[model samples]
Each structure stands twice: as structure tokens, then as C-alpha cells.
Target: MYVYRSHDQQLLNERVAQFRDQTRRYLDGQLSDDEFLPLRLQNGLYIQRYAPMLRVSVPYGMLSSTQLRALARVARQWDKGYCHVSTRQNIQYNWPALEDVPDILAALADVEMHAIQTSGNCIRNVTTDEFAGINGKEIEDPRPWCEIIRQWATFNPEFAYLPRKFKIAVNAVPDEDPALIGVHDIGVQVLQRDGETGFRVLAGGGLGRTPMTGEVIGEFVPWPDLLAYLEAILRVYNKYGNRDNKYKARIKILVKALGAEKFRALTEAEFAELKDGPMTLTAEEVDAMRSHFSAPAYDAIDDQPPALQDALASDKAFNRWYHTNVTRHRQAGYAAVTLTLKKTGRAPGDITDEELEAVADLADQFSFGEARTTHQQNMVLGDVRQDQLFTLWQRLDALGFATPNLKLLTDLVACPGGDFCSLANAKSLPIAEEIQRHFEDMDYLHDLGPIDVNISGCMNACGHHHIGHIGILGVDKKGREYYQITLGGRGDKTSRIGEKLGPSFDTEQVVPIIARLIDLYVEQRQPGEQFIDTYERLGIDPFKERAYATDH
Candidate 1:
């Protein structure tokens, strides 16, 4: 993790002091709720449905063991004994007292983390692939660029009060880990053309009441011009993006109304003005930032660990974990171990303090003292020695973090809906729980295979239902919870928005309808084909027909 300089440290410390005072005033009734709203939001405190929820930013989702320990301590002392990892790769505490939030922010700043830009209509945490630097397929590490953007956008004067919340994601690999880049406020993918590396910039992609994929404005922005290009886009959005109706305020709406070509022209004109400004990223500066993210040192070991092989041979549980939770690493003897949070009946992405401590210990012992939070709301201990796999698994299992259901139907990503969020239309956690109980059979899940069953309490797409292999979106029909299903959506190399499968189903009928849809896929799929592949091969007609069938 990058350490802050004395000047930067002073700035943050002073900001903490400011927030501490503000919080006191708010509690003392010196500040009205309306007056304190923006201040509280700026400090990452939200007055939720039941209590205040504080979202802590884990910038680019990178955390040191010390930082992880700090997080554990905060969770234990100030809030609940557990934290929910968000879809944006940040952490949220659901039950924090409004007054204690400043203390929490102070603790976070001690570890060089803060809640700035984690909420409100500004650039929320700039997310990237969890496998960023360590991925074998990366063109170049995108973290440096991400950090550059983080600094530039942090309290950026002009963009702080945009029409709506903005989000950005970058992936250096050909395969997109965090899907629907086309649907973000700004989606950047690092690409190489000939011998030069740069970005393919997409703007105005978003999902909510109205969902649209982003359009590519700049196909290949050279590495040195990253900030300049980004500023240009932000400028255009700030100057002309919608502000009349809150619902139509996202850049996605502007891009749609203006068309991609017109938007591109506006951004290009802005770019020409500030191509060599102070915000422009230079190779030297980029290199300096890159040094902070250099790969950890590793000891040479055999690619196939005999101990792992022996465990796989003897233990069916270990074999199942190896097949599902483990991913190939760039290093010969290393693997990326995904610690699934979707343990049967537990809430997805919820990690207890004890589990956090255990993960920190495992990272120190076998994962080069580092761990990553995936966009799918899971954790990855990258750089794990293959020989240490069994030992790590045992420790994680004891901590209740060993769920061998990665990419499976039961490994669903759901938002903290009516339970915590004030904006949610329905309870999403129960829906997820219902689905998990409905499909507890490992054999059935394995047979179904690699299905992304993403659910959101509403169309805000916080759970990214827009790109799920099977997207389930909650709708409120006359104050009753209903679900609308979509099919054939994918978030990988071939990204596409899902097509809706007709009428919405009542809450009671949703899970059974999903089961029927899966059964139809099973019946029609070619041997060994996954749900997504089968959907692509056969299209939506078969699944739609079965899903709406009266018998089902």
C-alpha cells in the first residue's frame, strides 16, 4: 500500500478534525439534519433504514495486513463484529452510531484509508480486477493509473457536485473481470496497439431505472495522456450532463441523448485544451506510482506440489476446492485462492472479525502478506504456494470461509437491500437466502454450472444484475415485492446486456421460476456446456418458454 507524505497526512488529519467537530454539532442539534446531510455523506456516514451505515473506502480494494487488522479492530470496537464487502470492492458497517463515525474515520486514516468519495454523486472508489498486477494475461498493471485517478478525483472541485453518482472501472487484461464497463459512468480498459499501451475509454454506461451500455469515446488514449483525457470527459459531463431530473442526470443519459459521436466530439474539444496541463500523467510520474505496486518476492517451488496432489488424491473436499476456488497464477508455483463468503446459509460477502484476523494471518503466512477483494464480493489470497493450499483450506474452513462454490449457482451476489439500504425497494438478502436453500444440492449446482445469479433489491444494479448469467431484479408492484428475470447476460470477454424474460413474478413464484429456467437449460444444453454458453447457443426462447409455463 502507498504511504501518505507528511503534507498529505496533515491534510487528512485536519479533515478528520473537521469531521469530528461537524459530528459533534450535528448530535448537539447545532446543525440541522439538512445542513449536516452533505457533511455526513462526505465523511461516508449514511442514515440507513434502521441505523447509520458507514462505508469505508478500500481504494482500488488493495489492503495491507496492517490495514486489514485496523479494519478488524474498527469492526470490533465501533460497529458490528463483522463487515459486508460491497460490490464496489469497499467495506460497509451497517450499525454504527452517528456520533462514533468520526472516531471510525480517524482510525481508518491512521492506516492511510478514508471514506472520501465512497458515497454521494462523486467518483466512488475506482475499481479494477482483483487479479490486477498478478494476472498472467495483463498488458500492464492498471493500479498506478487507478491511483493517479484516485488522487485527481479526490475532492475534485468541479466534479464533486455532479448530477448523479459516478463510477469508473479499469481492467488491464483482455478479459473483463468487473463486467459491463460499457455501463459505468466511465469504463476504461488498458489496451496495447502495436507496441504502445493506453486506454480504450467508454463513457455514459449505467444501470438503474434506465440501463444503457457506455459508448467508446476514445478508442486508444496513449498512456501519457490518461488524466488529460479523463479531465476532458469529466468537463463535458459537468458542463452539459443532465441536472433537471435526478433520475435522468447520469452521464449515461447524456450519452444516449447526444449520441456517441456528438459526445466524442465534445470530449475531444475539451481534451485539446488541457493536453499538457498539471493533471497530465507523465511516464516518470506513472513509473513512480508503479513502484508502490511491484510484485512481492517469492521463493521458487515446483509448479505441481506433491503435497497438494496427495491431498487431492485423498480428500474429495480438497479436490472440490482445488477445482473451484483455486485459479492459476502468473508464477509457476503459486495460485490465487478465492475465499468464498457464500457459505450455504451465511450472507454473501459478510466477514466476521475473527475471519478477518485469520485471513490476515493466512496472507502473511502463505500469500505474500497481501489479499484482494473481488468485484463479485469475495476475497482472494493471491500468491499462495500450491504446497500450502491444504493448510490454508483447513484454516479457512475452521474460520467458516471455506465455501467451494465459486462461480456456481448458489454463489449469488446480492445487495444489502431493505435490511440496511434506505433506497432498496425490497429485501434482497432473504431472496438470496431463499435461492440458496432452494438449491442446496451440490450435485445440482455443479450440474447447473457457472451460473451468475445476481440480484438487486431495485434497478440501481448495485448487485450488477444487468450482467448476470441469470439476472433477478426486484420490483415493487403495489407495495408487494416482485421479481423480473433476465437471461443471457454475461460480463466477461463477450459482454452483453441481458434480455428481459417477460412479465415479473411475485415473490413466492420467483425461486421456482428460476429453478424451472435452469431445468430448461439443462434439458436443452449440449453436453458439458455452461449456462451462459447454453444460453448463447440456444437463445432465450427455450428458457423463457419453460420459465413462464403454467405447470412451473
Candidate 2:
């Protein structure tokens, strides 16, 4: 994890005080609700349907054991005993009091974390692959670039209030972690051609109402000009993005209205002014930033320890978990482990304070005092030695964090929908839960292979329904809650928007319809085809026909 320097720490401390004063004035009636909305939002406080939801930024999803402990303390003291992991690698407290939020921000600041720029029309938290430095597949660690952007965009006066909320994502290996980079307002793919590093910059890609994958504006902008090129894209968006209607305000709309070619031309015109400007990243500066994220000192061990082999041979359950939740590490003998947050009866990403504290402890004991949060609402122990995995699994299993459903149908992505958010048309948690209950058979799920079932309470797409292989969007038909189904959506390097299956189904019919679709896939799929591949081969016609059949 990156340690905060003196300047960064001071900035966070001062911002907390500033927000505390603002909060006092708002509660004292010195500031009107209208006047205080932006201030509160800037601090990541949103007044939801029942209570205020405070979103805390976990930059690039990195967290030190100390930071994790701080988060646990804050949740215990200020929130309901747990916090929800958001789709953008953030933590959300859905039950914080309006007055206590200042204290929450102050607590976060104590650990070099803050909610600044988490909401409002600003550059939100910069997110990337959870397996950035440890995973062998990555071309280069993207964390340094994420931090550079986080520092640059943090309170930039020009972008504090844009046409709408802006998001940026980067990936070192776009081909490997395809979903992380494709669905952001600005997406960057870092590449090294020859010995020179550069970026493939894309702009105007986004979801919610109008979902579109970003278009490439610069195929290869040198490392020195990365910031300038990105700034140019933001400039174009700020100038032309629709502000007349909130519905049409995102950069995606702007990109669609002005075609890709025209938008690229406008951005290039702006880039001409900033190519060699002050914001151009320098080699020395990048190197200095990179030093903060260097790998930890690792101890050597065998790739497949006899102890691990013995444990796998003895325990089928542990074996199942090892096969599903463990991933290869860049260093030999080390492995990256995904801690599943989706326990059967619990909300997809909710973590209790005790479990969080235990996770922090596990990080100190097994990993290098650190763990990273995943965009799919999971956590990663980035450098666990394979030999210690069995012991770690036992500890995590006792705490119920070692579920073996990674990449399976039961491993779902969802948002706090009508249960908490005022923006939602229906409750999403129940739908996700019902689906999990309907398909709890481990063998059935394993046979089905990897699939993403994402549920959004509304078209706001907080759960990224636009990118799920089986996307479910909640709708309000008249006054009743209904779910609209979509098929063939993906958020990878080859991104595609999903198409509607047919009419929306009542709330009671959602799970049954899903079961029908799953049954259709299992019955008709090829030898090694996953759900998405099978859907691509067979199209939605067969699934739709089977799902909506009279008997079903």
C-alpha cells in the first residue's frame, strides 16, 4: 500500500476540518439545504431514502492493515456495524447520521483516506485491477498512474463541477482485466512499444441510461503526454456535454451526438495546446511515484507445498475454494486470493466490522499487511504464499469469508437498490438473493462455468447491468416492481451493450425466469462454452423463447 506523504496527509486533515465547519453550519441552519447540497456531496454524503449514505474513497482499491482497522473502527462507531463495497471500489455506509458524517470523514482522514471527490460532478475515485502489482498477467503496475491521476484531479478548480460526474479507469493489461477499463468516462490502456511507454486513451465511454464503450482518441500518447491527452478529452467534454438535461449530461451522450471522429478532432485540437504544458508527466516524477508502489520483500517457498497438497487431498471443500478463489501471482510460489464477500444469506458486498478487522489481521499474518478491494465487490490478498493458504482458508472459513463460488452464477454483483437508495425503482437485493437461493448447488454452478449475473435497482446501472452476461434491471411498471432482462452484455476488451429479451416480468417471476434461462444454457451449450460464449453462439432467441414459455 502507498503511504501518504506530509503534504497529502495535511491536505486530508485540513479538508476534514473544512467539511466539519460546513456540516456545522448546515445543521445550525446557517446554510440552506440547497446551499449545502454541493458541500455535503463533495464530502461524499448523500441523503438517501431513509438515511444518509457516506461513500468513502479507497483509491485504486488499495488498503493497508492500519487503514482497514481504521475503517472497521469507523463502521463500528458511526455506521450500522457493516459497510457495503461499491462497484467502483469504494466503501459505503448506508446508515450514517447526517451530523456524525463529519466524524466519519475525520476518522478516514486519520488513516490517509477521505471522501473528497467521491460524489458531485468531479473526477471520482480512480480505480484499476485489484491484482495490479502481484498478477503475472499485467504489463505494468497501473497503481502509480492511478495515484498520479488521483492527485492531479483531486480538487482541480476547472473540473470541480462538470456537465455531469466524470470517471476514469486504467488497466495495465486490458486483455486480462477487460471489464475494469472499458466502462469508464475516460479509459486508458498502458502499453510499452519498444522500450518507450505510452497509453491508448479512450473517451466518452459510460453507462446509466445510455451505455456506450469509449472511442479511442489517441492510439499511442507517449507517457510524457498522458496527462495532457486526458485533459484535452475532459476539456472537450466540458465544452460540449449537454447541461440542459441531466439525462443527457454524461460524456457518453456527447460522444454519441457528435460522432467519434468529430469528438476525437475536438479533443486533438485541445491537445495541441497542452502537449508540452506543465501537466506533462516527467520521467523523474513518474519514477518517484512508482517507488511508492514497489513490491514487498517476498520470502521464497515451493509452488505446490506438500502441506497444501495434503490439505487439498483431505478436504474437498477446501479444494473447491482453492480452485475457484485462488489466482497466479507474478512471483513464483506466491498466489493472489480472492475473499468472496457474497455469502448466501448476506448482501453481496456487505462486510461486518469483526470480519473486516479479521481481514486486516489476516493481511498482517499472511499477505504483506495489505489487501486490495475488487470492482466486483470482493477483496484480494495480493501476496499469499501457497503453503500458508490452507491455514489462511481455515481462519477465513471460520469467519465465513472463504466461499468457493468465484466466477460462478452464485457470485453476483448488485447494488443497494430500493432497500436504501431513493433513486431505485425496485429492490435489487431480494432479486439477487432469490437467484442465489434458487441455484445454491455447487456442482450445478461449477458445471455451468463462469458467468456474471448483475442486478441494478434501476437504469442508473450502479451494479453495471450494462456489462453483465445476464443483466437484470428493475423497473416500475405503473406502481408495481418489475425486472427487465437483457442478454449478451460484456464489459471486456471486446465490449458490447446488452439487448432486451422482451417484456419486463413481475417481481415474483424473476427467479423462475432466471432458472429457465440457466436451464436452457445447460441443455444447449457446447463442450467447454461459458454462458456468454454460448449466448453469443445461440443468440437470445432460444433463451428468450424458453424463459418466457407458458409452462415456465
Candidate 3:
């Protein structure tokens, strides 16, 4: 984790003071509700259905143990003793008093974190792959690039008041775990080819009312021209993206109307003049930024730890957890361990204060004092020694943080639906719970294999329902809660939007429909095929027919 400079610290301190005073004025009736809306939103405060929600940014989903401890303390003291991790890899406290939020921000600032730009239509959190530097297949760590973009976008004068919120994701690997080259307003994939590194830029992709995968505007934008190219894209969007209807205001709509060819032309025209201008990213500056994210030093150790093998042989639960939650690291003797948020009957992504504290302690003990939050709504210890895997699993299990389900049906990605969000038309948590209940057997899930089931409360696609292998979007049909199922959607390198499967199902019917869909897949799938692969091999028709079959 990088520490802030004295100037940056002072700026944040002053901003906190400013927000504290603004909060006081609002509480004292000096500022009207309407008047304070944008101000509060800019500070990452949202008035939810029950109480005020405060979203805290975890830059690129990276957090220090100290920051985790602070977050736990804030949750315990200022709000409910629980926090929700969101799809953008930020954490949200569902109940915080308006006055207490400034204190929370101050606490975050102390740890080089803040809620600034977590909301309010400006460039939001710059998310990258959680396994950035550690993944064996990664070409380069995208975190440094993400950090560069974060700094460039934060409080940017020209882009702060755009027609709609903008999102950008970057991936350094060819596999695209962050799905960075997919449905973002601007998707960037860092690639190394022919002895040079640069970005493959995609423009005008988003998932909301209209879902479109970004089109590749620049196949190979040299590393030196990244910022200038990004500036050109933003400038083009700022000038032409619709502002008349909020629904049509996103850059995706503009791209759709203009068509990808014309949009590419427009961006190229803008890029021509700005290629080597003031904002150009020089090699020296890129190298300087890269130095900040150099891989952590590790002591040489045996690749296979004898103690871990003994523990795995002796303990069934630990073995299951180790097998499911742990991943291979590029470092020979290290592992990246996922701390799953999905416990039976608990809300997906909800972590209690005690669990947070325990995770913080574990991060210090096992992961070199740093942890990561995945866009899949789980936490990760990216640098655990292979020998310590069993010990970590035991501790996590004791703290209720270890769930032996990763990429299973139970490990769902969901948005806070009608229960908390005003935009949601139906409750997402209940649907997640219902599905979890339906698929409790580990054998059944393991057989199903690497299924991504995402549910969104509504069409905003906050939970990334459009990209799930089996996507569920909550819809309201005449005030009744109904869920629309989409199959064959994937968010990986070969990304595709899900196709709808006939009529929507009522709340009770949703789970059974999902089961039927899975059953169809299992029956039709060739040996050893994952759900997404199977879906690709044989299209949505087979699953759709079986899911809606009248054999019951």
C-alpha cells in the first residue's frame, strides 16, 4: 500500500473539516434537503430506505490491515456492526448518522483511504483485478495504471459534471478476470506485444437500461498516450452524450446512436491532436508509477509444505476450504486465499464487525499486512505462504469467514435491492437465499462446477446480472415480485450478454426455475464441461426449453 504525501494528507484533512462543517449546517437546517443532495452524494452519503448509507472507497480493492481494523472500528461504533461489499469493490455501511459520516471519513483518511468520488456520477472507483500482481498468467500488475487513472479522474474539472456516471476498469492479463474490457464506459486492457506494452482501448460499453459490450476503438494505444487517449474519449462523451433523459444519458447510448464506426472516428479525430500533448503518459512517468507497485519480497521456501499436507489429510473441513478457497500464486511457495462472504442464510457480502477484525488480524499474520476485496464480493489474502494455508483456513472457519464455496451457486453476487435501494423494484437478498437453500449439497455444486449466478434488484445491473452464467434480474409485474432469468451470459475474455428465457417467474418459482436450468445443463453437458463452456457449446435454447417445461 502507498502512503500519501504531506500535501495529499493536508488536502484530505481540509476536505474532512469542510465536510464536517457542511454536515453541521445541514443538520442545523441551514441547508435544505434539495440543496444538500449533491453535496452529500459527492461525499458518498446516500439516504437509503431505512437510514443513511455511507460508501467507503477501497482504492482498487486494496486495503492494509490497519485500514481494515479502522473499518471494523467504524462499523462497531458509528453504524451497525456489519458492512456490505459492493460490486465495484467498495464497502457500504447501511446505517450511519449524517453527523458521524465525517468522523468515518476522517478515520479512513488516516489510513490513506476516503469516500471521495465513490458516488455522484463522476469517475467512480477505478477497479482492477483483485489478483493483479499475484496471478501467474498476468502480464503486468494493473494496479499502478489504475492508480494513475484514479488520480487523473478524481475531481477532474471537465468530467465531474458529466451527463451520467462513468466507470473504467483495467486488466493487465489476457484472461480479463476484472472483465475490464467488457461493459465499462471505458474498458482498458493492458497488453504486451512485439516487445512493447500498451493498452487496448474499448469505448462506450455499459449495463443499465441498455446493455452493450464496448467496441475496440484503439487496438494498440501506446503506453505513452494512455492519459491523452482517455482525455480525448471523455471529451467526446462530454460534448455529445445525451443530457435530456437520465435513462439515455450514458455514453453507451451515444455510442449506440452514432454506431461504433462513427464513434471510433470521432474519438480518433479527438485523439489526433492530443496524442503527444500535455497529458501524454511518458515512459519515465509510467516507470515511476510502476515502481510504486513492485512485487513484495518473499523469502525462499519449499513449494509443498509437509505440515499443510498432514492437516489436509486429517481435517475434512479444512481440506474442503483449502481446495475451494485457495488459488495458485505466481510466487512458487505462496497461495492467494479467498475469504468467502457467503455463509448460509447470511446476506451475500455482509461481514460483521467481529469478522472484519478477525480478517484484519489474519491479514497481518498471513498476508503481509495487506488484503484485497474482489468484485465478486469476497475478501482475499493474496500472499499467504502455502504452509500456512491450513492454519488460516481453521482461523477463518472459526470466525465464520470460511465458506467452502467459491464460484458455486451459493457464492452469489447480488445488489442491495428494494430492501435498501430506492431504485430496486424487488428484493435480491431473498432470491439469493432461496437459491442457496435449493443448492446446499457440496457434491451437487461441485458437479455443476464454476457457475456464476448473479442477481440484480433491477435493470441497473449493479450486481452484474447481465454477465452471470445464469443471470437473474428482478422485475416488478403489476406490483408482484418477479424474476427474469437469462442464460449463457459470461464476463470473461469471450464476453457475451445473457439472453432472456421466456416469461418472468414469481418469487417462489425463481429458485425452482434456476434448479431446472442447472439440471438441464447437467443433463446436456459433455463430460467435464463448465457451465459457461457448455452454454457456449450449446446455446440457450436447450436450457430455456427445460427451464420452462411443463413436466412438473
* C-alpha lDDT score of every prediction, in listed order: 0.85, 0.88, 0.86
Tens-digit lDDT track for model 1 on 1-552?
566778667878888899999988988999999998877787678899989989998877888787788889988998789998988889989888887888898998898888887888788889888877878888888888889898888878888888888999887888654534666789999999888888999998887878778889999998888889998999899888889998999999999899999999999999998887776777888888889888788778888888989999999988888899999888888999998888666678898887788889888998877888877889999889899999999988888777788989888999988777888888788889999999988777777779998899987888888888999898888998888998877776645688999999888888899888888888888988888988889888888888877864
Models, CA RMSD each: 1.5, 1.2, 1.6
> Which residue window of length 10 is worst by lDDT in model 3?
172-181
Q: Is candidate 1 or candidate 3 better by lDDT?
A: 3
Q: How many backbone clashes can be found in candidate 1? A: 3
**Model 3 CA deviation exceeding 4 Å by range:** 28-30
Model 2, CA-based lDDT: 0.88
- State the displacement of the C-alpha of residue 465, model 2, in Å, after optimal TM-score superposition: 1.0
**What TM-score, over all chains together, does every model reach?**
0.97, 0.98, 0.97
- Give the deviation of candidate 1 from the true structure as CA RMSD: 1.5
Candidate with the larger lDDT of 1 and 2: 2
- Residue lDDT tens for model 3, 164-236: 8899998887865464458889989999989788999988888887888888888999988898889989999
Candidate 2, residues 244-274: lDDT per residue as tens digits? Answer: 9999999988988999899989999999999
